[model samples]
Target: MEAKEIIEEKQELALALPLPSTIAVAINGKKKSKYVVRWALEKFVPEGLHMFKMLHVRPKITSVPTPMGNSIPLSQVRDDVAAAYLEEMGWQTSEMLLPYKTMFLHKKVQVDVVVIESDDVAKAIAEEIAKALSISLLLELHLVACFQGSAASYSHFHSPSLPMQRFQALSTINRTLLHTRTGSIETNSSRRQSLDIREEESFMSPCPSNSDIGYAPSQVSSARSFLTDDQSWISDQASTSDAFTESSSGSQVNINFELEKLRVELRHVRGIYAMAQSENIDAARKLNDLSKRRLEEADKLKEIKLKEEEARELARKEKEKYEAAKREAEYARECAEKEALQRKEAEIKALHDVKEKEKLENALVGPVQSYQEFTWEEIVSATSSFSENLQIGKGAHGTVYRCNLHHTTAAVKVLHSKEGHITKEFQQELDVLSKIRHPHLLLLLGACSDHGCLVYEYMENGSLEERLLQKYNTAPIPWFERYRIAWEVASTLVFLHNSKPKSIIHRDLKPANILLDHNLVSKIGDVGLSTMLNLDSSICNINTGPVGTLCYIDPEYQRTGLVSPKSDVYAFGMVVLQLLTAKPAIALAHLVETAVQDDQLMEILDPMAGQWPMKETKELALLGLGCLELRRRDRPDLKDEVLPALERLKDVADRSRDSAPKVQLAPPNHFVCPILKDVMHDPCVAADGYTYDRRAIEKWVEENDNSPMTNLALPNKNLIPNYTLLSAIMEWKSQSNQ
Candidate 1:
């Protein structure tokens, strides 16, 4: 039959409109690519949606580049990544899609995922969906398509001049099932339904099912009518035969010959009837044979489709194996490269550290600032021979003691056995601390390097890290205090970077090294790990390897071992983030950046730091993130970009502190209601002359006729609003919020 040609003609006008319900989103096995699925779900899933399918198209790679500028076939590559996620070119479709599937399942949505390997992503997706639709519906759909063909075929059969009741009846049947190209074997339920309908039609018609060998009821009716007419004519002829009998004696002889002739014609008619019956039996046998052949062809078609599906699956598995092996080889090559790089870095670091002291000492002309070199006995007397009671703290280089030296309160750092790198650290710290003096830098009083001791003006409150961590139950630092500390640290770093003779890089700038006094004035300390470079506009000094706390280390310096003013900038950025959240320095920059990007800055602000101003806090977060650029060139200059912004925030913070209520977080005891034992929302003077919350006083008056404060019996239940107390309470809350 012309099934395919006829269907294609009809398809020309079928209008293949874009089906929003069947959304096709392009994605891949890359991190964050699931957002495409999310976008499809949010945008199209709500609009009368039916099926949501995810499509991933992997590329086919024959060969990959080698480290030596050579090429290797992908088949030769090793397989070490997860076998399940592997594709021919190392595409990780299933590994990436697991999360997406879980998300869709949670949303109560059904989805089909296609992982295809073809360079043409769009074409692959198109053909895959088409294949899926073709075999899914197994019904009389092809028959539907034929009905849509030329109407003239049916119109010719229905012509009034040439048609009888049967042609009109057959037109209602839409032609025989065998006329078409082919059909799928009917399901048992469908076959039974057809049989039931045929039986019902037989009951409605006068002819029995076996009686009509012809196609329709019209042929059977015509044959029955012709038989009745012929019988009536024969009866009329028999009644006229007796009247003609007397006219023929010779006619009788002719009648006998006519009888013989009639008998011969009957025998001929019998022979023709027998031949027709034999022909009918042959047609029935051929019909059964054709039916069996049709079934076998359908089974073959089904087998072919099944084999095609199996082939596709096999190809997918092979592709996955190839990709996994490719990745394994790539991973191995990367590891080798990394090992070589690390070995080189280690050799450089060892060479740099060995000559570090020499480079620094040679670069310096003797100490610029001079001070008394105290005798060993004097140091011993001041620190009580390094008594534990005198010892206030200890650090990486030394133990510190509170001492009275030269009639001034001082912090004396006694070197811990002064050996190896410890000696160099002490001398470098002493040289830098003695030469430069700033209000925001710890003041160096004197040093006796001979006895391994150095003294400095004492700071009462210890380091900023202690305050932030609330060590020893110390009260949390106020937000304004932290703001000023950030500003002070920035300004001090800039001063060191811009120092006249050379720039000093605080290789280890962290909260623990920042000291605060009784008034909470922050100062930078611990110049032991500090490195000074020769006068150069480049402001970068080559070092062996990165040095400092890993959490606050500059990422660039940690990688390349290049020291610059920007390295200090990177560390200072982390310090600022810690000040804002009171969080640990590790990953603080990432957290703040993400929070700022999501507009969730206020959520991470340290709530303990009373009422942080949102405008200043977000700006501080942004500034901190800007300082933490991974590349040194990308970081903002400490003197110009970071300090100016911090200075403005400091000024705003100062105003906020000034405008805030002086009573810390709570109101004065007079603002408290006697009945409620808490600050009154609305103060009212009771008859007993004590102010109470409006609701509290009313409730008390309802149950008790006496005052709650002095237990005095009330003569009258009259109460007056305490406007003066109410005003004070309102002012307190307003200032506290500001």
Candidate 2:
């Protein structure tokens, strides 16, 4: 028969009026009544039947108990051995069977199956089965006493689709025992409520108690539903409380045939589970390694970028430094070129001056053959017809006259005697004087050979000595004019001393030869007694006859024939002293003679120069004495006497100008307020000693608090508000009140 037919037969038996623990069976139309008896003893009877005492008890287990004893029939031992084998395969057996019963009222049907379990678990099993079957009727559970022993009442059907439901139900039951109410397990009303009152024990162990259960022999031979080739037997076997329990020999035979089939299915499931787990592990490891490599690559990129930036920064700084150095080099080269240009210009100027001097000297020499000849006609023409008024002041040499030539005014000197040895020296004098044309020196325009004359520029004021001595009867020179004259004379002396190629010195530097222009610019006029300095030599010794005016002559140059620039400087100092004191250098001769004798120099100061600084005047007088020293070496040079004296005069002028009082006007009429007019016109305000009216201010202060109204006294006539005026008034009030 098929598995469906077998399942139908089992249900038909369960639905009978009553069911027994043991049943009689007939197979293949043979009257084998003993086979039923054997089936009862082999499959129906439970082990440990002697342990329970009930209404019916099994007298004893009469069969051979040892699984190794072959005396036990294969049919009786089959399920026991199978249970043992299942335990070795990691499954367990229950100690007891749970029983349940159900009645169909309309059909008057009673159904039951033996459930092996404890009393508390039997009620719960009955409820679970009733709910799954959608049964409304309450299940009635009963325990039965058989001839052999007391047996479980019945087993209820279980659903094959409830594996997940069963696990969740079991967890809820356990949680119920633990008193946790949050579980979501639900059951039909048919479930027994009494199970909640009776504390249920732990779930039963599925392992078999006896080893023989694992090694039992197979029964049912070719029972198509049991020892059959059909697929339904294995599935039907697992659907009920008896997952593989056999009700008869036919069922037992069916279970044995499907054992090998179930084994193959499980092995395939395990292989697939293991392969999936391995693949998951390998994928996880590769992902971790990839992540590590990516992190390292990112760091390397960052480091490279940082190094590139640093290199760029260094290159930029080097470029800036290079540019700066290049600019500095260019600047230095430009500076060097500028200095070279300046030096070249200075050299060119010096050469041009020397050339001009040579040209004038050649012009003045006027053919050396004519040194002894006197051409009166040519001299008259050169001197502009030698008119009577063309005569300037007469000198010891000859008549020195003014002339006009080439539209320029000039001075001419005509010698009285131009023959013999005197003629040769006179030509030398003319050559030397003509070559020197400095702003400080008198220029020799030309010589008059026919009239025995030389032409020179006319002096408008004649000489400084002549003007100062009142010889011209002109206006008296003011003090500032005199100081300026002094400065100009000193500057001229400095120019003469520093000329290149070293022009001659004027043996006479007296006031007579010191000529002034309209602006009072002085020049050293007559250079006839002059001698050209030898630039290459340290000293120039001239033993010629004395050629200078007696009063201004250097005593040493006369006594030792050592005429140097110092000899001229001494004569210049004497002239400066005469100018400063407004005294005649010749009159000072007597004073000098006395000073030289008495050495009481202070007594010699010129009375005309009143109230001069006595110390300065005395020192200057002493300097003049030193210039006229019996020994030439004792006198100060031009740089020491002239430059220092000029500097001192400038300092005095600066101090006097700085100290002079500044001009300020009186407060205007518009500034006069009606209230302040009384104080504004007060005598105190008008006095030079007071900056403002003191008496009116004093009267206002004496009034004390009444002065508050005095603010109205201030004039509103001022164009702008005078904060300074207000501040001064407030300060004055505060001081007076204190």
Candidate 3:
């Protein structure tokens, strides 16, 4: 009763439990089974277990021979054979259990293999399929095969049951219990009657008749008899069998309850699977969308990089262009600067040339001309534009050039007149030279009025200062020639001072101003400091300031600023001292006067002036001393004392020259002076048919008023030029130099 009560409770519990909404049905492809599918469809699928997926695992197909004796491919054979077998096995087309491929409703859902047989190949294939699908593998028996399909075939297929399999087993067990209950009751009643008879025989006899034995045997046969006649044993056997039936019934009830619980759990699990599958699909979609966006972003980044590279390339090209343009501009600027510098240099050179030409022109022309005007151009052309080769001499005033004008050779004096005072002095010199004309004086040939220049008759022998002071490579002038030069210069001074209306005071009378002609005759030139004094009493007393060369300037004239004819006499005295000593005028001036006063005339005499007459030299020295007196009034008068004394000295020199024995080694006649019989530095011709030293003839002309050779009264004191003799002398000199 307890067992029945427990069974009733379990049956109630099974009815109360929820049913599974899904089940897995595995069919056997080898058996061509439709029963497995049908049984699952009728039993579990109809109970609203909608997740009924049929897993029909086909056997691996083997190569089969065709009618043509060619082998058919295994895959084609399996498809055709499987479909045909299922159809022959009475599988309805309308009851279409979805194919195995369609069973994968959720890719993530775990698959369980309900293997119908324990075939290793099938198990391996199922494992491989599980691995390929990335799902779990569960080896299981086909539960429906155990129930509906031939039980004899599945008799060895023992496996743990699923909820559906266990529920089917319980139903089979419940049906068997109905038939076995009547048998169990009949056995129980017979066992009880045997026990009552055994108890009544205990009071009767121990021994029995044949009828008694027969009754015992019938009762024993009525009881489900055992080998022993123990009453306890019969009762224990009946109770034991009853307990076994009750335990079996109880076990079936518990299994049914558990199966119903598993169904409910399976339903819940299915719902979970469905929800998980839906979420997985959404997540996959979102992941796909994100991948697309990433692709697009990558493409955009690639485009941006390309643009940046293009921009960089363009900038680089622009920079190169800018650099190229800069280089071009710099080159152009440098070229322009070089060109400008070249042009500026050209302009400066041109300006310098113009200035030099202008200077040359001014130096060749005189500012004031009282004679024939010669164009500066003609003078430049004549002197080859004052080439350095044509330059004969240079002085404080200007340079002298030997130029040939209109076939007449002359000395051109170009004055320096850059300063205003020097320019005025130039004009004054021109005026003075233009007015003065004497045989013992320089002759002005022509002039250029615009430029400060004077053209004079060229003197071949240079000056008395050059001959006396410069003793290089030349025979010294004899005492007679020295005397002759002194006499000529004295007479020239007389000529200047004793002019007609007014005496011309030559303030600067030095040896340099005393020039020599080709005949070595002294002629006064460069009267740049000469000024005229009127013979009238008022003008005769005029006091002019000191103006002369420093060493030759009279001491009294310098002190008192009194310039007179006596001033010329003082300068002439300095020149005489220079000729006696053959020294510079300034050097002699400092010591000569003191020497002469101390009676040291012979001590200071130039040894170059050979065979000097002591008496005559002393006389000349004393006369120079009188002229250099400190007071102008105490100075010797040129006409009364200086002139007459010089004339007597000239006569003495000539007589001495005549008395001197002729040396066999005398110079050639062309080189010798006709009067002095010395090598003439300055040779000039007289109208009386003689080429005499210029100083000798001028002195002779002044004192005797006639030529020495002819002893005739001359028509004019003008000397004719002896070019032939002069040329011969120059040629001889050049040969001698070589």
Candidate 4:
């Protein structure tokens, strides 16, 4: 059923109940509860403690209103906020009334709290007085009782017209206040109407319908009450007291006739009222328990707060200690840095003192050598007065010149206006290169730093990239030639990797640094970007700064800031893949369009080298893929991969040789063979005439050809016995004998 129907049915059930003399407490007044209780005790003595049972009879009101026309369900809002506040305060409390039923409707309602306990003695006495007045006036002042619906009807009237009008307007302002403030008036009006309907019906038909079929109504058809005591009814006042017995009518029946009639009904009313009052007392006891529990909880909460505050203070002290330690460390670091600066300054001064001593020594020694120096006239004659054609190049550091010095062809790098030695970087490069010698590396012939010049063996060919990538040159280095070039470059790296005083890592290995000889062989040209690792120290250790170009950088090294020989391996793999594909490293990325799944590897190989047997090629590609694995540990050692790859190439060559056709063989001799003796006189051995070649026929003829002239006549008889075997044997001999 819908909510309204369920509610109506519940109200109807309450209405049909046979309650004894009932007293209603209207929640519309401003009287204090304790004072009201005292008044109720004195006035409605019959109702007594049963007043508390009215807690169950909450009513639904439309709305509440304020005098200024503002409206709200103020009672409900208050209850909700109060509930939340109570919960926040850790109160173990429950609302006895539903939120919907606990509101009062009033045009100018200002409600704080509402309570409906069973009417006590004072209220019950007032109700009796009203009933007696009605009987005397012969005016039927209906005391509407029982539950009524929202709309006013004759049955169980709940609200008087004057209060309802005020409530309707008040509900427009505040709905909650209306229901809470006027709950009793609303309930009483509706309840009394319901009682009147039941009373009228009880007289008209004491027994409700029995069908013509003679079936009686069910026993539960009528409303029922629970009280069963009959002796509790008050006897007639005249019969109990003689003072009221003075009348000729013998006042036993007349003086308290009304009271005697009430005594019967009031017996049950008084019981219900007593029960309600007991409930109120129990509620007061429970409220006391709740307040006690709340006090205990508050003490516990205060202890927890004290502990939390103590923990926060401890944490603050620790933080302060940590800050102090951090500051002390920073001060210590500053002191150390200051000491280092002072030490470096001292070393610089000592070196300056040594330089002054060396200059004094050179001053004494060079005095005689100064006499052999060329005069301005001789210098002018040698250089043809600074000819423009002699200037070979200009740079940020200096000018380079092509010159014939002591009848030797050389390129001279001269500083533009040097009052000193070359730049520290240039001098460092010179020092390193002068000590090193390799056929493929640049050779430093001499240095004349006093004159700011460096003389070296000149390279006629430009960089390898210039030769390969130049547009006009159009030099198509064949795949084998490119492989040879890559091998030469790899050999150079291998030498560097194993160099003494430790291996030097080329931090920037690229095509631009690769120079080519006249034969197009690769030679590593630059040592400026090289780093020498200490041989005694761990190999392939990380350095602080990031090294290598974006395209050539190992992703693992980039992510982890670690450098290793494997990092070089990754870069070399990139260069190798680049050379193999004949594409620059930037373009090499395009080939790796997707992940290198085993099956898709062929797609990543150089498309220029038309499909070769890919089993080993794929294996090689996988080696490159391993170098590119995100983890540094998975990449193979360069020597391990290179040696196997060379072996694979050798195997490919061997297989190609085996697949070639064999030369034709000379015809075998039939005269010596018993199987072929009959055909010995044949001029040629052909496919149609020979039963088998010398290799197979010799065995066959030896077993079957048993004639006396076995050497001269091969077996000419047919092996299978046919219907015309003799003719076949004759034809075989004629064809074979030559």
C-alpha TM-scores of all predictions: 0.41, 0.36, 0.40, 0.31
Q: Comparing candidate 1 with candidate 4, which one achieves the higher TM-score? A: 1
- Which number leads on lDDT? 1
> Candidate 3's residue-wise lDDT over 1-738, tens digit each?
533543453354445434333344455443334544443443333333445434544444345557898976655677777566545433432134334323333332233433322334344334443433211112224432233343344322222222222233333333344335555454433433443344323312332322232122112121111111222232333344345445556776545544543453454345335544654665687699899999999999999999999999999999999999999999999999999999999999999999878767766884433477899998889889999998988888789999999888899988877577667677677777677688888988888867878899988677777778653344456688788888888888888777777778888888778887655677888887777787663123335445668878777666666667877878888888888998877666668778877878788899867788989898988888788777777888877888889899999998987787532322454677867878776778777767887888888888887667667787778777677677767766664443
Q: How does model 4 fare in lDDT?
A: 0.47
Query: Relative to the unseen true structure, what is the Cα RMSD of model 3?
Result: 41.7
List lDDT for all candidates, in order.
0.68, 0.49, 0.63, 0.47
Q: Which ten residues in a row have the lowest lDDT in candidate 2?
A: 48-57
Q: Which sections of candidate 2 miss by over 4 Å? A: 1-387, 420-422, 449-452, 586-619, 651-738
Compute the lDDT of residue 369 as modeled in candidate 3. Answer: 35
Question: Cα RMSD (Å) per model?
Answer: 34.3, 33.5, 41.7, 34.9
How do the candidates rank by lDDT, highest first?
1, 3, 2, 4
lDDT of 1 by residue, 572-631 (tens): 989989999998887777888888889998899888888888888888888888888889
Candidate 4 minimal-lDDT segment of 10 residues = 212-221
How many pairs of residues collide in each model? 4, 45, 17, 64
- Candidate 2 vs candidate 4: the lDDT winner is 2
Error of 2 at 585 (Å): 3.6
